[model samples]
Target: MALTTDRPITTAGLAAQRQPERNRNVGRTLRRLPGYAAVALLLVVVTYPLIWLFLGSFKTQDEFLNNPTTSLPDSFTNFANYSQAWSSVATYLQNSLLTVLPSLALIIAFGTAAGFALEVLVWKGRQTTLMLFLAGIMIPGQMILLPLFTVYFQLHLTGTLWPLIITYTATGLPLTVFMMATYFRAIPKSVFEAATMDGASIIRSFISIGFPMMRNSVLTIALVQFFFLWNDLLIALTFTTDDAQRTVQVGLLNFTGQFGVVEYGPTFAAICINVLLILAIYIFLNQRVMRGLAAGAVKG
Candidate 1:
């Protein structure tokens, strides 16, 4: 009889056996190199203007004017442009904060409450109310511009930040409500039922349990509203006639006008500053925004 032998498969032997498969995968990856290269090229093309704008911010007026095609500035450390730009728009920046902060607070507070009431609480006309809110989203902002302006003008609010605040808050509501409601709906009905059994009021349940559970949705709403209010030029321009009440967008436009001739360095620097502020906010809250959106999508 032939001797029977059995050997355990060693790690090295297993790896050797898989080597061909690994090599095939690598070969497939290599075959996709042209696609990767094209994507990289596309990214560079899309980003080049922003990069140029940032680099141009560092150049002196003369350097920017004389060497429009040049990519680098003579002195990267020169911050005079930024200082000048800030000096020009400091009050406008303050006004922006004043307008946006309160509007944002209202948007989150009322939006979440409305969403909870619609989704978690049993009520008459809930579906109708939700339909109304959702319908508002379909209305064109431009369609209301003339009527809104007339109303604000009659109220003598045209030159003040109040109109901007009110408009921002109002325009932001439909989307906020929709997002929050979608998020709230994804929550199990049993959660609210348990609260009801415990003698918890709708307000109490919303404040305690709902708020904590919907943190991601709240962040998403906040981020969206923040960007809208911060970057708003059309509303700001239409509503605010006072220089002191101008937000950053109108302020930037005025900055160009104040110089009579455009000062490219300071203009670019101001643009860079605005872009950086938005970019910083996005970077900081990006994870939360993604989480909120994903959670809402999955749950809704």
Candidate 2:
């Protein structure tokens, strides 16, 4: 036998063997380039209008009219459009705040309690109650608009923010309760049992344990409800005839018409302001909202 030598493969040898596989993966990724390019192009198509609107908000009417497609303004520091927009809708923004804040508070409180009770507590007709709440989601808002208007008119609430608050809270309930209940159901039963063993009442347990655990869900509900209430032009227009009682959505429309000629810069500025407010809230609470949605989808 020729001097037989046994040699073990080193890590380098293994890596060399794997390099072909890595190269193949890289080639596959490259082959999917068209798909990625399509997705990128779709995103640009969808977002271009929003980008244009934002940039247009900064331009003077003459500049915008002259070069409507221009991406940048001559002066980025000019804020007259923003000032004019804010001044026009200041009261409507206040009205929206007044309507949305109290309504959100009530929705959270009631929805949390209702969900916790239905999911965690042992009771008769709980399923039926849940079904009833779920049924509200199926009812088209337009179908109820006439009846709601008539009711509000009878109660002399059509001209005030109270009707808007009540309607928003009521309409928001089905989804809020559904989301909250689904999230609450996902909590382990042992947690509640442990709280009970510690001499905690349902109320105390919910306050101490459930609330913290479901914080993300609550944020999600708040975010959804905020958007719903904020962008509600139809309901605001239907209920609020007075300019003083109008929400920002209605105010923006009225603002556009006030001059008998549309000032694109100021109008776009107002739209941008509204969009920014919602966008800011989304950026802040987005992570929590996603967590809440994921938790809700876990079991129900």
| Per-candidate RMSD, Å | 3.2, 3.3
| Per-residue C-alpha lDDT of model 2 across residues 1-300, encoded as one tens digit per residue | 698687898999999999999999999999999999999999999899889888888898788768747558877777999999888777888999999899999999999999999999999999999999999999988898899999988998877888889998998899889888898989998999999998999899999999999988898888898898889888888888897888999988877645587888889899999888888989988888888778778855
Q: Give the worst 10-residue stretch by lDDT in candidate 2.
A: 62-71
Q: Which pairs in model 1 have colliding backbones?
A: none
Where is the poorest 10-residue window by lDDT in model 1? 254-263
Error of 2 at 173 (Å): 0.3
